[model samples]
Every structure is written in structure tokens, then in C-alpha cells.
Target: MKVALVGNQNSGKTTLFNCLTGMNAKIGNWPGVTIERKTGTIKGTNYEIVDLPGIYSLSPYSTEEEIAREYIFKEKPDVIINIVDATAIERSLYLTTQLLELDTKVIVALNMADILEKKGIKIDEKNLEEELGTKVCKISALRETGINKLISEIKKGDKLKRKPIYDVEIEYLISTIQGILHSSDSKIRHSRFLSVKLIEEDERFDKYQTQEIKHMTGLLAKKYDTDFEEIIATQRYNFIEKVREKTVIYKPVKDDLSDKLDKIFLNKWIAFPIFVVIMFLVYYLSVGIIGSNTVDMVSNIMDSFSEWVGNTLQSIGTSEVINSLVVDGIIAGVGAVLGFVPQLIILFLCIALLETTGYMSRIALLLDRVFRKIGLSGKSLIPFIVGSGCSVPGIMGTRIIENLDEREMTTMLTPFIPCSAKLPIIALFSGYFFKENSGLVSASLYFFAIAIIIISAYILSKLVFKNTSNTYISELPEYKLPNIKYIAKEVWDKVIAFIKRAGSVILICSIVIWFLLSFSFNFEYGVDIQDSMLASIGKSISWVFYPILGENNWGATVSAIQGLVAKEQVVSSMAVISGFSEEVGEGSQIFGNNTIFSSFTAASAYAFMIFNLFSAPCFGAIGAMKRELGSNKKLLKVVCFQTFLAWCLATVTYQIGSRIENGTLHLADILVIIAILLIIYLIVKNSINKKKDKCINCPYSDSCK
Candidate 1:
């Protein structure tokens, strides 16, 4: 038997999925869609479950909403579990009403019941069950409460009666619409709920019905000289308000630590500053303090094992081919990716804690004004925050954003935010080159990414995509103390996903990259190709990156190779070519006296790091962009623009820095000046043109939704 889980945004459906499936869940894209569909099996049961994306309604407005609606309508699961956030039952009920109109059977899982009780909100489960005419299970998916009851309910496989408890006026409207039915049976038969939907102007559902409903409703309206639908909608909302009054009881808001924190954290003037401080603290702990120390210690242990294994192979008369493959190919490749695991854990830990404590949403609210100025809505903040872990999941998080153009732009630029995968590269360069000021380097890189995104959004808003007409309305959920168990589970899930990806795609790519550098058919002999490939490729592309990376630095050389795969591989690729085992600490130097190290100026290294950090992200990011943009042409544009920007930034940095270092200007310096002037001109032209256009004609320019 197959079952599907659906829910509203932040409705705890994912928590339920995690609890039921444990470690058995598999996440991948839905066929022909970028939306991720999580598949897993219920433990010790024959039943399997599919966790569809959390959506507000079964409307074909967004990819996530479409996926949920399609799965239920087409796949026709044996059962559909609609997880509802119990605290905000009124808003959540909107989706519930729509789901009941569908062909599939549904069980309402009222999640977060524990939180509701704690807030002194009372829900009469029996009353709710009778009113909905479906099985209602009050389950706290996070606390493992009422889960057994839910599972047993699902296992029973009983169908409940279908009924309506609508207001009398709405019910009358429904009956009147039903009286005009063209046939007693039509696959596109309109429900009373759907009839009301047409009145409410629900564009998503109105078209799904046959023309009979529209024609009949029009005739009735003309006969009455009034649109009955609008009158009934007002009555339905009134009835819902009355139900809410009886079903929900609210007490005076209580003061808590979370509230106290929010007072300072969410202050309009200081919130941005506080966020900055918090970010610094995150990096300080993750990369500068505890996490960084742990990684160095673990790397030292791995280094010992590497040396021991190398000696053992030497004693056994192992061939250079075997040694390089084992040591350089397998060890260096996988180890390079694994080296950053500690930092990843700490990063995930911080994010999880913040999110669990409800700090992230506050950040979203505080940053909304700033984001709006850049032509993005505050809803995009979730995707940007999620992107900090990995661009793939980050892009997936844009499902929460309701607007198409805003979501697409967010998805396109989100990869610019440095994810955990790219942390290793940043840490490597900052440590090796910049020393203890690594924090500043890392922070500057982050700021650079933000700048790039803001600039891109501005340009895209004016030139490519126009601002969406949909207005943004977000509520700030009252803050509460974060549950430790919830935070730990969230953090651990992220870490596991990271490890799984590393074990699969990244591991394979690492091996393949090792293979490419391992063998080459030379003029007379098949030689190990590291040196030859570096010499050939580096020399050929040396002139292109010379302004930024200098003539022959290994950093530039490895970057060229890494561009074929991912930006993170630049650091790993350099480590391999430099013949460093896992012996290096965060700040430990590996290769090149003044030659490799001094080949490029300090400014050049900074520029090189910035380019890689902001440039198209990894393959995962590209795939995510492709999915979210829903167009190959758009993805290509993003990729091309990122690369172009990286080149321009790098070129200017090298020219200016090199000139300053030598105390003499060169032709490159002149080009850098010209490029800077051109950028300034472009910005001025864009701004002037926008103002002129707005002044000339704009229907809703005053209200930039």
C-alpha cells in the first residue's frame, strides 16, 4: 500500500516523515520536476510512504503545490495524510477544505499538538473529527507522541463518511449550484466547495470544472441580480470566525526567554547588527574555535594512518602505480572532502539551533526591507538560509515563496551564498594565505556573495524579469524556547544528507578526478599525468588568469582543473598536485617556497578566492538553478553571468594589487581603471533608465509589490 503526506508550509510534515521512516528515507527530484519527493517505508509494515512537498493548497500555482495536487489526482495513493499545524488551525484549515474535494481518501494529522496545549489552546478532537467527517489524529511528530495511534489508524484502512458542516447560506448556495448540474455524474463535476471557489475567484480550481458550473452560476446571478457566490464567501468566513472562537481559547501572551531575546534581536535598528554579530560568532566557533580545532586534530590522526600505510606499501614492494592510486587517488580525493566534515557539523549545529529557537524567521523579517530594495521579497530569505547548508536543498526551500518571479530569482542567486561544501575551500585559502585573519577573509567572501546577489537581483529586476504583482504578507510566529531534541534531529538530518551525498556523487567524482590525473598516454609511454596535465593546461590558460592568479602559481593551475567539476575541488586539486597527504593542519603550509606561494600577489589570491566562491557554485548548484528556473536558457544565462563577473573582479583585483605591490603601474592597471569606469557607467545608466521609465508610465510603480 502506498500513502502520501501533504501539509502547509512549516506544518511539521517533514518531522512526521523523519519519525516514520527513520533512516530509510530517500530524497530525489520528482519525475520531470525540480521538486524533491521523499520516499520511505513505515518500519515493520508492508506500507510505503511518499512525502510530497509542503504546500499551502492543492493549487497548480507553484511547483510544490502542483506536485502535491498531481500526486493525489494521478497516483491516487491508498491514503493521503494531510499534516496540519494545530496551533494555527484556522489558516491550515484552508488547505484541508480543498483536499476533501479531491478523489483520494485523507486522514487529518493534527501535528504540534503538544505546542498547542502548552499555549493553553484547546482543541476538541472529537468535535473536529465529526465536523471534518474524516479520521483525525492528534500527533506530535517531533516528540513521538500519538504516533502509534496515528500508525494504527492508517493501518486500519477504514473509509469515513463524506459530509459538509458549512454555514446555511453557503450550503444553500451549494445546493442551488448542484440543482443546475448538467449531469448527475461527471468526472469534472463541481463540488459546493468548488462552486464557492469560483465565487472567491480561485483561478487554480475554477478552470478544472466544465463550463456548466460557470454558465449555471452566471444564470443564477442574473436571475437574482446579485452574485450569490460573493455573498456566500463572506458568510463562510463569518462561520469560520465563529468556529475559531469556540474551538480556540487564547490566554494573555506570556513573557519568556525567547520573547526577551526577540526584543533585542528583532529591533528594527539593531537587528541587522545583532545578526552580524551572531554570524561572526557562528564562524568563530565553527571555523575559528572548536570546530576548526577538532578538524585539525582529526586530520593529524588521518595523516599518521596515511604515513603508516605508505610505509607498509613500500615494505611490500608496492608499485608507484598502486601507491599513487591508493595514496593520491583514493586517499587524497575522499579525504579532501571529508576534511571539512567537522566544520560542516558545527555550521549545521548553529543553523539548527537558530531555526529551532525561531531566530531565522526573525532574520527573515528584519532583512525583508533590505531584500525588497534589491527586488526580492522577504520570503526568499528561507531559501538563502537553507542554501548555507547546500545549494541543492537551499533551492528546494524556495517552495515556501509563493511568487514565481521572486522564487525563480532567489533560486538563481542563492547558490552564491557559501554552502558548507565550499567552506573547506575558504578555510584552506584563508588559513594558508591570510593566517589568523581567516575570519575576516571568510566574512569578506560572504559579504562579497551578498553583494553579487543584490547586484544581480537589481539588474535582473530592471532588465530581465519584472517585479511580481503578488504582495507579501508574513506573520511572525511567537518565539519560544527551542526543543533540544528537535534541534539535534534537524542538525543530524542535515549532517547525514551531507555524508550521503559525499559517499555517493562526490565520492565518485573524486575517484574520477583522481583517474584523470593518474593516467595519460604520453608520446612514448603512459605516464602519470599530474605534472604533464598541469604544465599543458596551466601554460595554455596561464595568460587568461595571469592578471589575477599570476603566471604559474599552482593555485591558478588547480583552479583551471577544478572548473571542470566544482569550485571546492580547487583546494583539493592543489593538495593532490602538491603531494600533501592528509598531514596538513588548517594553517600548515604544504608546497612552493616563494615560487608557488609568491607566484601570485596577495591581492591575486584574494581575487582568485572571490571568483571561485561567487562563480557558478558547484554542479549541485547548477542542477538546482536549472530546476528552479525551469528553463535551460535561463540557467545558461546565470552561469555565463557568474563566470563573466568572476573574470572581471579577478582581473581588476590583480591589476590594482600588482601595481600597488610593485609601486609602478602597467597596461593591466590601465585596463582595470577602464573596467571600473565601465561598471560605474552601467550602474548609473540602469538607475537613470529605471527612474525615467517609472516617471513615464507604471501602473503600480507607487506600490512596488
Candidate 2:
């Protein structure tokens, strides 16, 4: 049996799904839409449950709504588990009413029932069930209460009675359209539902459009002196209100904990500062002194293991080439990444805690105004936050964003946030360059990334997504203590994913890089690394970074290039090439002591960090970008734009910082200064052009005369 879980945003539908399925869910996007579809099997049962994207209505106003409506209409699942927030039943039942119009079994799961009880809101579930013509099950998804009962209700296969939500006139029009659809031999399975949808001019049913239906809709609009869609919507809302009045009893209560906490956390003057402090704490705990201690412990273990492996192989009389491959290539490379797992786990834990406690959404609420000024919805912030953990899901999170332009822009910019894969690089570089202030240095990179994103957003809004508007509508869930079990599970899952990547992509890349670095072009072993195949290839592309790093350091170039496979590989590659396989304390220490990094000044090291942080993400994230973008052209455009921006910014940082530190100017410095001036001039010229082009006929236009 197949069950569909449907509900509004923050309605606890996902929590219920997790409770039902445990850890056995498969997550993917709906066909042709970015809206996520999560499917899982109920434990020890043949029943399959699908959790649809959260939507406010079945009116097809957004892609999420369309996906939900289309899935119900096409798939006709065995049961519809209509999850509704018990505290907001009136608002939620609007969708429930529409669901009842469908010919399927619907068991209304009144989620967050505990919250309702705490708030002194009494919901007459039996009355609600009778009014909506379905069985209602009260559940607290957070506590995993009433899940068995809800599942039992689903297994019972109780069908809901279809009810009319509109007046006689609208009903007559719907029936007329239904009759027309039948007469035309349209293959639309749900004629009644399609008829109502057609009357509302739903773009999904535009194919079934006919003169008769259009004429009848036009007549209805004329009679109502309003939009036909609005008329139908108003009636549905009215029915919802009536149902609420009959079934809901509310008692006034004093300020709750959530409200009290929001006063300080969401205060305008302190909210942003609090967010900054929280983030700094996350970094401090994950990559600062605490994280570094953990990293050192892990690194020492890896170092000891590598030494053991080398000794064992030598005892067995392993070949020198084989010994180097095993010790330097595989062990050092993969070990370099594994050493940062502690830090990654800590970071993921903090992010998971923020997400579960619902503070992430509050951050979105607080930043909405600022996001709007950059031509993005506050929803864009969610992706950026998620990106801090990893960019693939961050880009996928863009599905919640409705505006196509804003979604695309958000996808493009999300990788600018330092993801978990990039954390090792930050730790390595910061530890090497700043030493005692590694945490502060790593934290500065995050702020620098945000600065880049804001500036890039502004530039892209004007240059690419001109005149695009974004609408921000988000539901802030009540604050609750985060579930420790959930946070641990999430952190474990992320760590496991990182480990898998290290074993697979990073492992493969490591072997290949080792081969190239080990052999000359003629396949002769034991050549000087500078004369080896990898070095030759690296030299060919090394000039790209000369402006930033002050020399064509093929080792640095190779590390940067390898980062495209996985960001951690940047440090790992450097570790292998710099002969730090045995040391393994941190890549920074290895690089700092090696002659390979002798030419790198603190300014150049930071420039390198900036470049790597803002460059195109790893192959996995790039594939995600391609999938989310759904266009080869757009993906290529984004890749090129990201690379160009990283180059310009890194170049500027190196040239200007070098001059400031040493009080010396070079030809490249002059060229970089000119480039910066040109960029400023272009921005100013674009602003002037926009002012000149403002519409004179419009009241809001600045050039109106």
C-alpha cells in the first residue's frame, strides 16, 4: 500500500514521516520540479509512504503546489495522510477541504497536538473528522506519539467522503465543466477536480481548456464582479472558517517560552549580533582551540598508523615505488581528509542543532529585509546556511524558493559559503599562516565569503537578473529544545557521507595524482617531481595563480586543481607532494616547514584561501548545480562566472595586500589596481544607466517627470 503525507510548511509532516520510517527514507526531487519527494517503507510492513513538499494549498500557485496536486491526481495513492498543525487547524483545513474533494482515503493527522494542549487550544477531533468527512488522528510527531495509531488508521483504509466547498453557482459551473470534459472525451481521470481547477484557470489543466469552459468561467467572473479564482478561494476559506468555529475552542494564555526567547533572540538590535556570535562560537568550537585539539588527536593516530603501515611494508620487502604509493599516496591523501572529520562532525552537529531548534528559520526571518535589498528572498538564506554544511543540499534547498531568477542566483552563490569539505583547507591554511589565531583566521574567511556573496548578488542582480522581484513568505516554527538523538543521527549521516567521498572520489584521485607525480612522461619511475608528468601538467596551468601566489608554484596549482574533485584534496594533495605523509599533524605545519611553501607569504596564503573558497565547488556539488539549474548553458555560465570572480578577488587581495605589507608596487599591482577601478566604474555606470532607464509613466520610477 502507498501512502501520501501532505501538509503546509512547518506542519510536522516530515517529523511524522521520519517517525514512521525511522532511518529508511529515500530523498529525491519530483520529476521536472525542484520540490523534494521523500519515500520510505513502514518498518516490517509492505506499506510505502511518500512525504510530499509542504504546501499551503492545492491551487498550483507554486511549483511545490503543482507537484503535490499533480502527484495526487496522477498517482492516486492508497491513502492520503493529511498532516495538519493542530494549533493552526483553521488555516490548515483549507487544504484538507481540497484534499477531501479527491477520491481517496484521507486520515487527518493532527500533528503537534501537544503544542495545542500547551497553548490551551482544544480541538474537537471527532467534530473535525465529521465536518471534513475523514478520520482524524492526533499526533505529536516530535515525541513520536500516536504514530502507531496514525499508521493503524492508514492501514484501515477508511475512505473520505467528497464534499462541495463552493456555493450552488460555483458548483453548477464545476459540473458544467465536468460535463464538457466528459463530452470532449478528455482523458483527465479526476473530472470533478480538474473541472474545479480549470475554472480557476490553473496552468496545469490549460490543455483541457475549451471555449465552453472559458465562456462559463467568464460568466462566473462577470456575475461575481471579481476573479473566478478569487471567488472560489474565498468560498473555500469561508468553509474552513465555519469548520473551525464548530470544532476549535481557544483560551487566552500568557507569554510562552518561545515568545519570551524570541524577544531577545529576534530583537532587531541584537538578532544579527547574536547570529554572528553563535556562528563565531560554532567555528570556535569546531575549528578553534577545541576543534584543533580534536584534530591533533586524530592526526596523531593517522600519523602513527601511516608509520606502522610503512614499517610493515618495508619489513615485507615491498618495492620502493609500492611503498611510496601506499604510504604517501593512499594513506597520506585519505588520512589528511579523515583528520578533519572531528571538526566536520562538530560543525554538522551545530548546524543540525540550529535546524532542529528552528533558529535557522528565525535567522531567515531576521535577514529577509537585507536579502530583499540584494534582490533575493529571505528564503535564499536557508540555502546559504545549509551550504555551510555542504553545497549539494544547499543548492537542492533552493527548491523552496519560488522565484526562478532568485533560485538560480541563490544556487550560483551558495557555494561561496565555506562547506564542510572546504573546512580542512581553512584549518590547514589558518593553522600555517596565523598559527595561534587559526580560529579567528578561519572565521574571517566565512565573513569574507559572505562579503563576496553580497557583492556578487548585487552585481548579478543588476547584470543578469535585472528587475527581478522576490516574495518572502516563511513560517517560523515554535522554538523547542533540539532532540539530541536527531542531532547525533544527522551528524553521523553527514560524517558517513564525507567518509564515503574520501574513500571513493578522493581515493581514486589520490591514486591518479600519485601516479602522475611519481612518473615521468616516458613512464620512467623515480624522476624528479619537477620533471614528472604531474609537474609538467601543473606548470601548464600554474600561471593562472601567479598573480595571486606571486610565482607559478606547480604544487600549489596542482592542489587547487585537485580541489575540484573534493575540497579536502587541496590539503591532501599538498601533503602528498610536500612529503608530509609521515608528519600528518596538519597540512599547514607540513607546508610551513617545506621548501615548496617557502615563497608563500601570509598575504599570499590568505589570497590562496580566498581563491579556493570562492572557486567552483567539487564534482559532486557541480553535478548538483547542473541538476538544479537543469541547463547546460546556465551551468557553464555559472561555472565561468564563479571562476572569474574568484580570480579577480584573489588577484586584488594579493596585489593590494603585498603592496600594503611591503610598501612596494609592481607592474602586476598597477594592472590589478586598474582592474579594480574599472569594476567600480562599471558599477557606477550601471547605476546611472538604470536611473536613466526608469519608466517615466510609472509612479514609482525615479525618472518620472
Candidate 3:
């Protein structure tokens, strides 16, 4: 037996899905999330519930709605749990009507009934069930209310059929449209629900449209002297109004905290400032104060373990090669990266709090004007904000943008924003090179990242997506105080995900990296890198980074080589090079004791940080970009552009710094000039190419052109 959960967006469908399945669940990319589908099973039941992506209607305007529609029509589940927002039944009923048309066995799970009661609105469940011809189950999915009864009903396998509730006028109109469609096109045959959809010019019904519907739609439009879609919309609302009159009762409203808070939070002038302070506080707690300290402590413990392992292996008479792989390459490479899990957990915690409390959406709304000026919708802000967490998920978040052009633009520029994984590298470089002003250095790097994104967006706007249209509309959910239990669960879930990922993918990749930097038959040395193949490869690639880093800097180059798999690996490789010593803290005197930066400024350490920070993201991010961008050509373009841009920024910074430090310009100054000119030329060329195509603002033209 199977059960399917369906609902409108933000109607608590997912909350119910989680509650029903408990820990017996799995989350993956659906069409909206990416990939194909995500499924989870109910524990100890023959019923395996599939949670359908949130959709407004089954007319299939978007991929998510199509996925939902296809699943219902194809798979034909034994029971359907239509999760509805009792408080927002007017909007919620749209999808419910479509579900009724499917003629499947269904029970209405009126979720968020608690919220409705607080709002002084009451739903007559028995009357609704009688009128709609289906069973009604009131549930507060989050609070575990009515779940047992819901489960019992599922087990009972009692099938209920609902005659779709429609007004008399809508019924006549739908009949007229259906007859017209069927008469006009023999090919287009569906239930009356689809006939109404055809009148609305739903593109999905085009394939099902017979010549009859086509001719009938034209005749009706001439008869009504209005577009058929507008006519259908009017009918839908008319039906909703009648149903709402009968089933809903509104009592005297009282002013609540939700309303009071909205006045302050949704205020145009004060909201952004408050939001900025909140964001600063979140980062301060995560990366600056408590979280960083926690991470540092964990890192110290891991470092000690690594040191003990190294010493024990040597004392046990193990070969140097074996000890190096186990201690230096694998442990050192992966541990340095994994050490930041605590910080990530704290950061995710703060974000989850903001999300749960419904503040994140407010920020998006507040920033809509600013975003719209750049030809982006408020939805684009969602991905941009998420980019700070990690570009992979950030880019994935672009799926929220209904407009294809806006989505592409968001995806292209998201990686330019510094993610959590890149934070350690920035901290290391800035702390080591610029004493006391570490926060300023970090903030400047972040600002620089934002600058790159804005400049790139502006440049691309003139070239790539010039013809694309932008329509911005986002619903703002009422603000509520966050639940403590929910916040804890959210934070814990994120932390566990990070730990699990580190243990699996990062650990395995670290081992591979260790092998690459460890194994080699060194015929010349009569051995390898301590007799390893990876050492030979690192040496071979060392020269490639020589101009910016140095030929003898095997460690830096090795870290860069490992950085392809994960950006944090660069720092891990550094720890390995520094001998995995627990004593080596952020401001280690031994390494900087002989550093060349204070004396000579050519390709200085500061410039190196800028380069690494701006360079192409890790392999995982690249793969995500490829999948989101949907083309290999676009992915390659992003990588090349990022590398080139990083080189220019680094070259210029080094040349300028060297001139200031040495009291004279060096020959490398000329290389810096040429690099800057090349970047400018590319930017101009992209703009010119877009202009030639008659596209005024191609938002992603920088890479596309």
C-alpha cells in the first residue's frame, strides 16, 4: 500500500511528511530541488509515503507541478493525504480542487489548525467533509496532533470519493468549455478539470488539446470579448468564494505579536539595518567568537592524535613511506578541513533560527527593490544569501527562481561569494600576513567577493540574457517566534550532515590525495617522495604555480593540487607540510620567522590570499555549477573566467604592493599591466558581442558571450 502527501508551498506538507516517516526518511533533489525524485518510507507499515513537491495547482505551469501531476496520474497511489493550510484555505483550495479531479482516494489533512485558531478563524471539518464528499482530519503536523488517527485511517484503507466542490456558474462554464474543447479537437480528451485548464491556456494541456478545444476557445473568447485564461481565473475565484462562505467562520480579530512584529520587521527604512546587524551577529558568533573557539579546541585534539599516530608508527618500526601516508597525507590533509565542523554547525544554527522564525524571507522582501534594479527578482536574493553558506547549495537554491534567465544569472555569480569552506583559507592568510586587523582583512575579502559578483553581473547584463523578462512576486509568510526544539533539530541536522559528509566523501578523497602525493618510483633518488608517486607529481606541477608561489614551495603547490577536490584541502595540505604539529597554531612563529613577505613584496602572501579566495571553487562546486547551468561549455567558461580573474587581481595586488615596499617598480609590473588589460578586453568584448545581438542587458553575458 502507498500514500502520497501533497500541498501548496509553505502549507506544512513537509512537516507532516517528516512527522509521519520520522527518522525513516531520506531527502534528495526533486525536480525543484534538482535530480528526479525524493522518497521516504513510514516505519513498520506497508504504506510508503511519497512527499510530492509543493505546487500551487496541477495545471503544470512548472516542472515541480508537472512532477506532482505525473506521479498522481501514473503511479496511482492507494491513498492521498492532501495537506492543507487551514489558515490559508482560500489559496490552499486551488491545489485541493485539482487533487479531487484525479478521483483518487484522499483524506484532507488540515495542517496548521493551531495557527488558524490563534487567528480567530475556525473551520467546520464535518461540514467541509460533507460538502466535499471526503473525510477531513484536522492536524497540527509540527506538534504531532491528530497523527495517530491519521495513521489509523491509512491502515483502515477506507476509500472516500469527493465530488469536486464548484459553484453553479463555474460548473456551467466548465461544461461549456469542455464541450467546446472536445468538439474542436478529437485529440484533446481529459476530465472536465483539464477542460477548464485548456480555457486558461495552460501550456501543458496543449498536447492533450484536440482541434475541438482550440476552435471552441477561439469562439468563447469572441463570445466573451476577453482572454479565456482571465475568464477561467474569474470562475475559479467565484467558486472559491462560494465554498469559503459555507465552510469558513471568522470571529473578532485581535492584535497579536505577529502583527506588531511585522510593523517593525517589514518596515522599509529600519528593516535592512536590523537585518544587517543580525547577520553580523550571526557571523560574529560562528566564525569570530564562540564557534571558532570551539573549532580550534577540536582541531588541537585532532592534531594531537595525528602526532601520536606518527610517532607510534615510527617507534613500531613501520617504514617512513607508510607512516607519511597514514599521518601526513591522509590524516593531515582531511583533519584540517574537518576541524571546521563546529564552526559550520554554529553558522547553520544561526541560519536555521532565522529561517524558522521567518526572518530570512523578510530580508528577501526588503532587498527586492535593490535586486530588481539589477534585473533580478526578490527570489534571486534567496540564492545569493545561501551562497554565503556554500555555493553548491546556493546555486541549487536558484531553482526557486521561476525565471530561467534570473536563475542562470544567480548560478553564475553565486560562487564569487565566499562560502564557509573558503573562510579558513581567508582567515589563515589574513591572520598570518596582516596582524591585528584580521577582521578587517576578512571583511575586505568578503566585500571584494561581493564586488566581483556585482561587477560581473553588470557586465553580463549587457551581453547574455538581454531578451529575458523578469516578473517578481513572492509571498511573505507571517512572522512567528521560532520554536526552540525546531531550531535545535535544524542545527543538529546540519551538523550531522557536515560530519557525515566529512567522514564519507572528504575522508575518501583525502586518502586518494594522499596516494597521489605519496606514491612514486624515484629512479633518480633511488626512491620516491620518501619513496612515493604523489611526491613526483607534486614536484612536476610545482613549476606551474612557481611565478605566483615559488618552485621550491612544494607544500603550497601540493595543497593547490589537493584543492581541486575540496577548497579546505588547501589548508589541510598546509598543516601536513608544517609537520602536523599541534603546537603550530594560527600565528606560528617558526614558519613566519623566515618568511620573505616583510622584506620582498613581489607576489606577496597577501596577494596570494586574494588569488586563492577568488580562484575557481572546488570540484564539487564546479560539478554543481555544471548541473545547474546544464551545459559543459558553460561550466568550462565559469572555471576559465574565475581563474583568469583571480590571476589579474593577484598580479595587480602583488605588483602594487612590491612597488610600495621596494621604493621602485619591478619588471613584474609590466606583466600585471598586461593581465589587467586582458581582463578589460574580455569584458568589453562580451559587452560588444551582446550589443551585436540586439540584447541590451544579457545578465550572464560575461560567461555566455
Candidate achieving the largest lDDT: 2
Error of 3 at 499 (Å): 3.8
Per-residue lDDT of model 2, residues 279-331, tens digit only: 88888778887666776677778878989999999999999999999988998
Q: What is the alpha-carbon lDDT of model 2 when measured against the actual structure?
A: 0.82
Estimated TM-score per prediction? 0.84, 0.91, 0.83
Candidate 2: segments with Cα more than 4 A from true spot: 24-34, 155-163, 172-188, 207-222, 580-589, 663-705
Question: On a 0 to 1 TM-score scale, where does candidate 3 land against the true structure?
Answer: 0.83
Query: Which residues of candidate 1, in runs, are more than 4 Å off?
Result: 1-3, 21-35, 39-48, 77-80, 100-106, 130-135, 152-170, 179-190, 198-216, 219-232, 256-258, 291-299, 477-531, 580-587, 591-598, 658-705
Task: Output the worst ten-in-a-row residue range by lDDT, candidate 1.
Answer: 25-34
Between prediction 1 and prediction 2, which has the larger lDDT?
Answer: 2
Cα RMSD, each candidate: 5.2, 4.3, 5.3
Tens-place lDDT per residue, model 3, 289-338, is: 65435554766687689889989999999997688778876787667667
- Which pairs of residues have clashing backbones in candidate 1? none
Point out where model 3 deviates above 4 Å.
24-36, 153-190, 201-203, 211-223, 291-303, 434-437, 483-486, 500-554, 580-591, 594-606, 653-705
